[model samples]
Target: MLKHTGRRQQILVALVAFLVSALATVLASTVTTASPSVQPGSDGKSGSPGATSTKPSAPSSLSDPRKPLPIGLAYGDTLTWKNDQELAVGLGDAVDSGAKWIRVDLSWNDIQPDSPKTYEWQRFDRVLNGARARGLEVLATIGYTPKWARKAGCSTDDACPPADPAKFAAFARDAAKRYASQGVHMWEVWNEPNIPFWAPKPDPAGYTELLTATSKALRQADPQAYVLMGGLAAVGTDPSIAYVSQGDFLTAVCKLGGNKVVDAISYHPYTYPYLPSAKTSFGTAMEDISSAQGNLVSILAGNGTPDLPIWITETGAPTNGPGTATDGKTIPPDTTHVTEAYQAAIATDTVQAAAANPHVGAVFWFSDQDTGQAADKQHRSMFYGLRHFDGTPKPALAALKAAILAYEHSR
Candidate 1:
């Protein structure tokens, strides 16, 4: 009887243990079934197959090619009585009227009054700081020699300078460093160095030397800023006296040690008494100036500097200057013939043409004021301004405003 009872108890205990083990296994399985494992997507880059993306999309505005046109105005004390106050006022007006940049003439003479010793920086600092305060970008052109620094043959009659490559380079380096500290960028080594008006004589070697020295020194001063070569005045009529036919000058420039020192080729493709149209106007055609610029582009493209751009530093028609100056040098009679309306029309055409050129990064009108020189009397003397000396709007001023409006609308 005792053996039978003991066996029965052991069997019952085993059954209970088996039932508990089965329940625990069922609970473990339920826990695992509640959680899911991550699966790879079709692309293998996403959470699951055909999963909706949560990544941010690119902004719509940045995806377009069209951008705001860079409009610049030529402002210098030589033309207008420019002081810090006047600069502020002019800059304010420029910003109001759609000018993105201000071309300031940093005459080598102005910054360095003497040779090799000291630099007069007060005026430059004033101009730079004033412009900055007013929110204006500067396209600074450094050229012209002071009476003391002029080479032996350089005439005091005008602003021309003899080629003293070393001295000029030193000035450039110092000026660039001083201004760079002020956050000023964008420099044009010398103004129209290929022309006799700016140079003592037409010598490509001399110009190249000046360019190389100044460029290297400028870069040393500020590696981040840009250095633009001065514009080649169009060889309008008499290509001989025009200071190394525009094309030849450009070719010479390119052949000289390549464009490692230069960034952009500055040009003055002036349209004196011409307007933009499908057909070439009387004195204007892309082909006319293409001889110079085309060769430059080709050379740059041939080299690896295909991305280099161009800037029309100065462009427009002068109603008064001699129509025969092939070098496109303007002998200002003190004013210009472009009436307010006429000037406005030309201004509009200029902006439009500049905008159309993909390689043209910027264009500055030749001048801002009539230069208050009443002694000289010619259309060049009387007209150049978008306003009169008293600050009244001219038709050309209106035209510029309209063009800017049109540009804004197109964008």
Candidate 2:
């Protein structure tokens, strides 16, 4: 969620350590940033560079893989500028890969850049059109305040919260009305409100205030639609960072009755190096989202929102980053580096873990394709994609498809 802002300084510092490894040699000899086995298409077709053309085979009719537990994906901003053909291939891949849902941004800043009276829906309309044609469900994330709406004296960043909650609610109501015909009902309020994405500083009470108004507006626009609080981050406490941890932030929100405002809870459990299915007493976020005593699971139950569902809106690991001479086998504190095989295992295990947990409703991988080689905030984020930047499918893609199929058939 804070992808554009390199504000996770503590996490970024640990991510910088990701580099080439004498240790990675033990994991797999041919493993590197560029996987040798990466091919052009998921369906055996050849696509030229930049993923311009690689027709994924039509999704199999054998059985609906999305029946029991489905996987969803966010393509980052790759589809924002792609042509219709390229957009079809990306969405097509999601269908062929067993994804039932597709997450999209309905940014307030983008749709209403000037006066609040004027609105633009064409850009998002194009994406939603493609998603519906592919039979994919939409989770529209609503946030990124326009400059006019930002509180006075705040930095000129889009992450700033609006000066008034009612104004923000009006925007949400309009977005929901405009898209109700297109079958977009699920809404995720803001992205990463527990961090700098909320701007200046994160405030649980303030976010609860915003959610109360926004959720009401969404349901009013379409009575059937559900609202999800923005996906809280998945990292533990670090003395270096000024942001509140997801656990503490959720506690404050629940204390203020936030759980009663939103229809469900959204969380991002981005576990790398270690898998989400692991059971241990370690301080990883898996405990915070799942088994730990004071975790969010218990938080909701104690707060009187016992039946509320948990949506894993985002989670995934990167296969490679800036290669370092340090031993990658030992694993650094915040690095996202893992081999392609390991990443594939993450795809499979993430589904398995969610399927085993009754509280988790859906799982969407953070990205659909690798973005680029350049690092953001010293973290090589490009490699998190299940496919290469050139539109070639990675091993993780097939792993995700198989996991979804397994889950469906078992049910």
Candidate 3:
């Protein structure tokens, strides 16, 4: 009878153990089926099959934060006007003033006037060799369509776009090949294409086509070449004068995929008659050029190119130094005139502002020295140089040097 009771008790304990195990298995199955494995960025959300996560990563910047912002000089026609001795003096001043780059006009017309096969690179060769000798990098502005390459009715207009994009591309390839060995890696596609002064009329699509052709040719010639978009003139919207606002022009160009070809966007953010920090009627401030830069960043980001750099390729105030008005009257000196003192102060402030902005890769003072052309007198472009036409140093030269040095040291 005791053996029978022991067997019965053992059976009862086994039954309880089996029941518990079954309950645990059922619970485990329930939990396993209820919970789904989620991948990173999924956050337990459902998506279409093969769809990527909607979360966007941080946008990248084109400006290399690792490198110091280079200070450059926009001595446009200076190279063409100055002899070897004069060129040396100008470049010497640039180097002494802490400028690492000098922008010179590489006129397409001058290079190949008659035919694409006919090349006259003597002037450019001298200028480029001179610049390299002085340890100054060149940002060659290669544009101004030759008469033979201009479109119909645009024969005399150097500002006209090439009749054929291939012609421009050929020119770009030749120039890049010729100068690639001289450390001339940076090229500004053209001057201000956003105005009639550069293009017959601002056509973003045409500009993009030209830029793409030129850029591809350049990269093919020199794998390390950087193609910067033409510096957009900082002019107000005046369609009557064929002037598109800088913001509008940039937006249009960027939308048309200009960012795809160009490594950087260049602008002449001149707040002439006002400080760089002053606000324009268009609700943007010139002092903090970053505001305009930010607009460009947004445009590029929207176009899936968030990493393009912004170059202030031209920015400086022009002084009214010994110039008469076109009306045959003495131009009265006013406080508005970019005097020596004001130019110095402005130069210091402009560089300081640009250096502080991470988007700004370079700041090019409009000119190294003033020009003597009578036509320049009618426009402010004639007097935006750091030195007078005679090569005497303007107060802005010392100020710019000090500003660049201080900024570099601080960095």
lDDT of each model, Cα atoms only? Answer: 0.61, 0.74, 0.74
Compared with the true structure, model 2 gives a TM-score of 0.79
Residue 138 displacement (Å), model 1: 0.6
Q: Tell me the TM-score of each prediction against the true structure.
A: 0.72, 0.79, 0.78
Count of backbone clashes, every candidate in sequence: 11, 5, 3
Q: In model 1, where is the ten-residue run with the lowest total lDDT?
A: 55-64
Please identify which of the two predictions, 1 or 3, would achieve the higher lDDT against the true structure.
Answer: 3
> What would you estimate as the lDDT of candidate 1?
0.61
- lDDT string for model 1 (1-411, tens) is 999999999999999999999999999999888654421111222111122212111101111135455577776544223665666666665665677677878876776666557667776777777677767777788877777777677757335554467878888888877777676767877766567756545566667677777776776776554667777776633546646656567667666742545656677776644454223423353334333335555666665555556677776544333332222233234333433445566788888876766666677775555544444535463446665566655566667767877877877
TM-score computed on alpha carbons, candidate 3: 0.78
Give all candidate RMSDs, comma-separated: 15.9, 23.3, 11.5
Q: Which residue pairs in model 3 clash with each other? A: 276-286, 276-287, 277-287
In model 3, state the lDDT of residue 230.
94
In model 2, the runs with Cα more than 4 Å from the true position are 1-67, 76-78, 238-240, 322-334, 374-378
